[model samples]
Target: MAQVLEFRLPDLGEGLTEAEIVRWLVEVGDVVAVDQPVVEVETAKAMVDVPCPYAGVVTARFGEEGSELPVGSPLITVAVGAPASDPDSDAGTEGSGNVLVGYGTTEAPARRRRVRREQQVPVPVNGRSAAPEVVEGPVPVISPLVRRLARENGLDLRELTGSGPDGLILRADVEYALRAAASPGRPAPALTPETTVASPATASPTPAGTRVPLKGVRGAVADKLSRSRSEIPDATCWVDADATELMRARAAMNGAGGPKISLLALLARICTAALARFPELNSTVDTAAREIVRLDAVHLGFAAQTERGLVVPVVKDAHARDAESLSAEFARLTEAARTGTLTPAELTGGTFTLNNYGVFGVDGSTPIINHPEAAMLGVGRIIPKPWVHEGELAVRQVVQLSLTFDHRVCDGGTAGGFLRYVADCVEQPAVLLRTL
Candidate 1:
C-alpha cells in the first residue's frame, strides 16, 4: 500500500503570511522528483517557485492559479512507495529531506491523506457540456467580490463560462459580463417586460478608462507606502550640487575600466560614507520602546521601477563594498528586479534607501521612507547649467539631492548634515577619496 504524504506550503520566511498561486508546474498523476519545483507563487516581496520534499506520484493539488493560500496550507498530495501507473516511471520511494528557501526542517507530525474520486459532470440531453445559446449550469465562483457584482447586476451567473482555472469565475469575468450587458444594441439578462430597469442606452456607462485591480506587487506597494506615511513623522531636506567632477571621474574610471561604474553606484558609495559620519540618519525608531535604534551595518536599498511596480532591492553590507563591488551588486539586483527573480531576502532588511528618480526626468521628490527604515536619499537629473566654478562663471553638470528622514530618529540638523556631506561628495569626487 502506498502512503500518501501531504505537502503544505512551507513558511517562506520574512513574516510572509500568504502567497498567490501564479502557475502550476505539475498535474495530477504526474511523477515528481524530490526538490523539484511544483508551483510558482507570488508573495508580497518576490516571486518564488515552491519545491516539493518528496519524490512520488502527484495525487491532488489544492487551489487554482490566482488563488491566495495562507502559509502552511496544503499544497499537494504525493503517493509515496507506490508503483507508477507507467512501467517506465521513475519516482523514487525516499524523500529528499529538502525544504523551502529560508526555512529549516523540524518535527512535523506524520500526516494521513485521503483521496477521493472527482465528481463527474453530467452531459445535457443534447450530449454537450453546455447549451447552445448560453452556458447554463452551476457557476464556479469563489471570490465574494465576483458574487456581489453578479448579484448587483441582476445577471444570471449561470449564463457565463468562467475563464479562470477549472472554469472558475473571476472578477474579470463578472466585469466583462457587465460590460457586455451594458453594451448598446445588446440584450440584458434577467430583464422581463414586467421589470422596470434602466435601458442599455440609459444605464450608467462603464468608465472608458481601464480598471486594473490594485493587487500583487502594486497592492503591496500601496500598503507599505500608506503605512509609512501614517506611522513615520518624516521631513525632507534638499541641496543643489555640481556633479561635473563626479561625472568626469566616472568617465575616467570607465575609460580605463575593467567594469563600468554606474552613476547610481557612485551615489550609493557616497550615501554609505555619509551614513558613517552621521550614523543617526541610518537608524529606525523603536516606537514601543520610545527609543531610536541605530543600525551597525549599511544594508542599502535602491529604488528600481519595473513593469510589476516600484521595488527597492537592498545591497547587503554596502558600507564594506567599494565602488566596483557596489556596481556589481547593483547590476545583479537590478537584473533580478527586471526579470522578477529576486528572493524575499534580497528585497528586505534595508537600513536605508536611495531613490534615483532622475531616470524619470524629474527634478526632485520628497520620497517616502521605506517602512522601519530611518531615511531615503533621492537624486535628481544631472543637467548642464551655468555655475560659478573656480570663482568664474562656467557651465557644469548640476543635480538636486533630497534626503527624507524619520523625524523621530533625528532632527533637521542631522538630516541636513548628511545631505550636505553627500552633496560635497557629489560636487567634488576628491571628498570621497579622503573618506576612502
Candidate 2:
C-alpha cells in the first residue's frame, strides 16, 4: 500500500509567513519527481516556485489559485510507493532532501498528521456556550495578518463567515466586522462576492469607488511607508546641480568602453563615495538601544517600479564595486524586478536607497526615507536648462539632488554637507576621483 505524505508550504525565508497561490504546476494524480516545482506562489517580496519534496503520485491538492495559505498549510498530498504507468520509475517512499526553510523530508511524514489530529478538539467560541461548541479544526483562516487584525480588534474569528474560498477568512472579513461594530446604530452590511471593507473614515460615505485590499506587495509598501512616517523624524535637503561634466564624462567613457556605463551606476558610485565621507548617513537608528548603528559596508538599494508594485533591490557590498559592476548588477536586478523574480534577500538589507525618480519625468520629489535606514538620495531628471556656467548664462544639463535623512542620526549640517558633496560630484565629475 502507498503511504500518503502531505507537503505543507515551506517557509520561503526572510520572515515571510504566507503566500498566495499564483498557479499550479501539477495536477492531482500526476507523477511528480522529487524537487519538481509544483506551484508558483506570490509572497509580499516576490513570486516563488515551491517544489515538492516527495517523489510520488499526487493524491490531493489544497487551496485554489488566488487564495492565500500560511507557511505550514498543506499544499499537496502524495502517495509514495504508488504504482505508476511506468512501473520502473516508481519512487518507492523516498523523498528529496532539498526543501526551503521550516521543512525537511527526512523526518517521518506522520508528525504533521499527528499534530492535525491532536488539534481537532472541541472548544467554546469566545468562551461562550459549550452547548454549540466549535471544533477547533483548521479554522477557515490562512493569513496570520488576518488573524492578528481580528484579535487586536477583539473580534472572534468563528463568528464572522469568510467571503473567501471554502469560507476562508480574509483581511476584508475582519475589517468589515470591525466597521459594523463601530457603528452600532447602522445595520450591518450583507457580505457578498463584491463586498469589501473600507477604512473607518470612509466606511459611512458609501462612495462608488472600488476598494482594493492592501495585500501582497501593495500592503507591504503601505505598512513600510506608514511605519517610516510614524517612527522617523526625517528632514529633506535638495540642491540643483549642473551635470554637464558628469554627462560628458559618461559619454566619453562609453565612447571608448567595451561595456556601456549607466547614469544610475555613476550616481551610485558617487553615493558610495559620499557615504565614505559621511558615514553617519549610512547607518540605522536602533530605537530600543537608543543608539545609531553605523554600517561598515554600503548595501545600496535602488527603487524600481514594476507592474506588481514598487520594489527596492539591494546591491550587496556596493562600496566595493566599481561603476561597471554596479551598472551590470542594476541591470540584472531591474530585469528581475520587472519579471517578478527578485528574491527576498535581494529586496532587503538596504543601508541606503538611491531613488532615481527622474525616470518618471519628474523634476523633484521629497522622498520618504526607507525605514530603519538613515537616508535616501533622490535624483531628479537631467534636462537642459539655461544656467550660469563659468560666470556666464548658458544652456547646460542640470539635475536636482534631494537627500532625506533621519534627524536622529544627524543634524542639518551633516545632511546639507552630504547633499553638497553629491552635487559637487555631479557638477565636477573629477571630484569623485579623490575618493576613487
lDDT of each: 0.81, 0.83
User: Where in model 2 is the C-alpha error above 4 Å?
Assistant: 88-90, 101-205
Error of 2 at 187 (Å): 38
Task: Tell me the tens digit of each residue's lDDT in model 2 across 1-436.
Answer: 8899999998788777888887676778777776767787888898777877888888899998668899999999999988877654545748875785322334433211111211222345787644434443445664544654566467777676678996688778787888789787886654332234555774677655546678888888898899999999999999999999999999999999689999999999999999999999999999898999999999999999986779999999999999999999999999988877888889989999999999999999998889879999999999999999889999999999999999999999999999999999999999988988
User: In model 2, which residue pairs have backbone atoms overlapping below 3 Å?
Assistant: none
How many clashing pairs in candidate 1?
Answer: 0
Report lDDT (Cα) of residue 255, candidate 1. Answer: 100
For residues 199-281, write the lDDT of model 1, one tens digit per residue: 36656784443245566677788889999999999999999999999999999999995999999999999999999999998
Candidate 1, lDDT over the whole model: 0.81
Superposed Cα deviation of residue 339, candidate 2 (Å): 0.8
